[model samples]
Target: MNKMIALMLAASASALLAAAPAYAQDASYKSLTDKATADYKQAKVACDAHSGNAKKVCVEEAKVARAKAESDAVAQYRNTPRELGKARKDVANAEYDMAKAKCGDRTGTDKTTCMNDAKAAKTAALADANTGARAGTNVAQNPPATMKENCDAMDATAKAACMTRNAASSTKVAVEDSVITTKIKADLVKDNDLKALDVHVETVNGVVMLSGFVPSQAQVKKAADLARGVEGVTDVKNGLKVK
Candidate 1:
């Protein structure tokens, strides 16, 4: 169950970690953080009744839930790569804390192994967050105009190949993401089943992000399935908030 949770966390973070930068912090986010903190206090109060190791686990679980709620609120409010990276770290930290607490339930070397696994998971999540931060910084540094200038010197055939290169990030996954985004957009334009929906698609490192409002959950599923069916898509992040 813990492993399943970690895999889901990996998937969820990868998609959300791709975002544009925010120029200014907003009051709405402050309000959300306050609410989340209040909720955490209430949850902790409720968890106070449990005893011993159970009490510790309950406290950790409450903290984890609160951390997730707070992170989601931050990401939603800012929708920036930096904020997303922080959110990912916050979630990973919360999960790691819970995992460590759970390790108390184990005995001897088994406990050591569990703690080691938790550390590995935390390290991986932090590394991913760091990569996302670097990717965002690279995009900021390498403007599209510079890439266009570089491609301008190539022959028509060479330029055609070079055009597939991502101006955002130079990773191979970015190349696949570029083609996948274009194909998915084209598919949306021509597919009759998706006619009723207005979806915006973006891809970062082969993870497709579908935003904008959808008519229904069915439409959300349809859009996600369509993107998943695309050849280069590593994963689909359905952000289509239903109406």
Candidate 2:
């Protein structure tokens, strides 16, 4: 009957509509992956211009860029807040790895401090990411309970110092440095003239270190200027090389 044909056409339209979003998501995922791959390749090519510890650092930076891009792609495909938070954590871990690699170029107390600062930055970033994930799920945010447990093994005086140091490090300088680095990175990403992927940003005690590769001396100056403009950035160590 004519009514049966009308029903069939309506069902087909409904099915098509239901499939459209999934197709769009798949396309988006592919696009992100393609861009990530291209960026990784470009970053690796930049690494070819360096040697020794600098070369190692450059390779780690390239890996960090690729990890961030891939994680972002997955997060977009899932379209969930938790996935986005996980993507952030993934990027933090990549940055941590790169930071440790940079520390290999130092020695003694300097290297120790570098490693500690890197760990602190990672912890602050992970904590923020966890809070974001919980907030997205309508859960209350609290400092992880392990923070207290970690100090429990020490004696009274040591424990007090440990707790004080942990509290101060977590809530003050490390957090501020992380915020500055993030803002600078966001700014760089927004600037069309900068190859944001080719630059690695690291902050410690308000000092921002701009590393990795840039194409021109102007961009090197632009990056340092951008970092210096960020709030809480006391100084910029422009290690960015013109390639």
Candidate 3:
């Protein structure tokens, strides 16, 4: 009888152990679902408040949020033997239909173009949804700005490349601004204090490449240092000659 009781207790402990993970999974699923639902509701409300092209864009954004929510719910359901996958696909289809309805009144090339644009937007939205499901939602909304900041923080050549890839307009402005600032600094050096000194500032790929002549090593270092401090200069290539 003692042996029988021991076996029953062991069986109960094993069952509880098995159930623990299932319980944990359920809790996790619930949390994800609640957050996703809240995001979708917020998006819907925002979309409904706009009009015209802005409204269209807002709706597109909301669809992306909804897609993400549905995808998360479906993924959680897949582990529990539910029909949530089918429901998620249905939600995706419905989103497509709504997009089409929103864009239907557009006329001429605008109509066809609008439809194509809507399709592309929906595709991108789905991609974003997938990314959010894996990495979280905030990353999707702020990627460009975050990438630009990271690029700006890099050293010289790499920073130039990063800015080129991530922020073209800002990079262009930075390069031009560096060139102008370099010219100003070069003009400030006392010409009589230096001889046979020529300052050349060339910008390429958003990096300042300084080439020319200076009277002394001090002037050379000064020119390069000034170039480095200019906004948008990824690097300062010092190729100055000291007489």
Q: What lDDT is obtained when candidate 1 is compared to the true structure?
A: 0.69
Error of 2 at 59 (Å): 1.4
Estimate every model's Cα lDDT from 0 to 1.
Answer: 0.69, 0.73, 0.55
Tens-place lDDT per residue, model 1, 98-132, is 77887898889888887887787667656766666
How close to the true structure is residue 112 of candidate 1, measured as C-alpha lDDT?
A: 89
Residue 164 Cα positional deviation in candidate 1, in Å, after optimal superposition: 21
Provide the global lDDT of candidate 2 against the true structure.
Answer: 0.73
Tell me the RMSD of model 2 versus the true structure: 15.0
lDDT of 3: 0.55
lDDT tens per residue, model 3, 1-243: 999999999999999999998898778877777887788678778777777776775665566456545544544433221233343344445555555765666688877865775565446434433433454322112233433557646799998886667656544454454465455455545444433344534443345545433457898887777667666566775655442
Enumerate residue pairs that collide in model 3: 156-234
Q: What C-alpha RMSD separates each model from the true structure?
A: 17.9, 15.0, 22.1
Instruction: By lDDT, rank the candidates, best first.
Output: 2, 1, 3
Q: Model 3, residue 225: displacement in angstroms?
A: 38
Better of 2 and 3 by TM-score: 2
| Runs in model 1 lying further than 4 Å from the true structure | 1-25, 137-233, 236-243
lDDT of 2 by residue, 33-91 (tens): 89888988898888989988898888888778887777647644753557757876787
Model 3 alpha-carbon drift over 4 Å, by segment: 52-60, 76-88, 101-105, 116-243
Alpha-carbon deviation at 160 in model 2, angstroms = 58
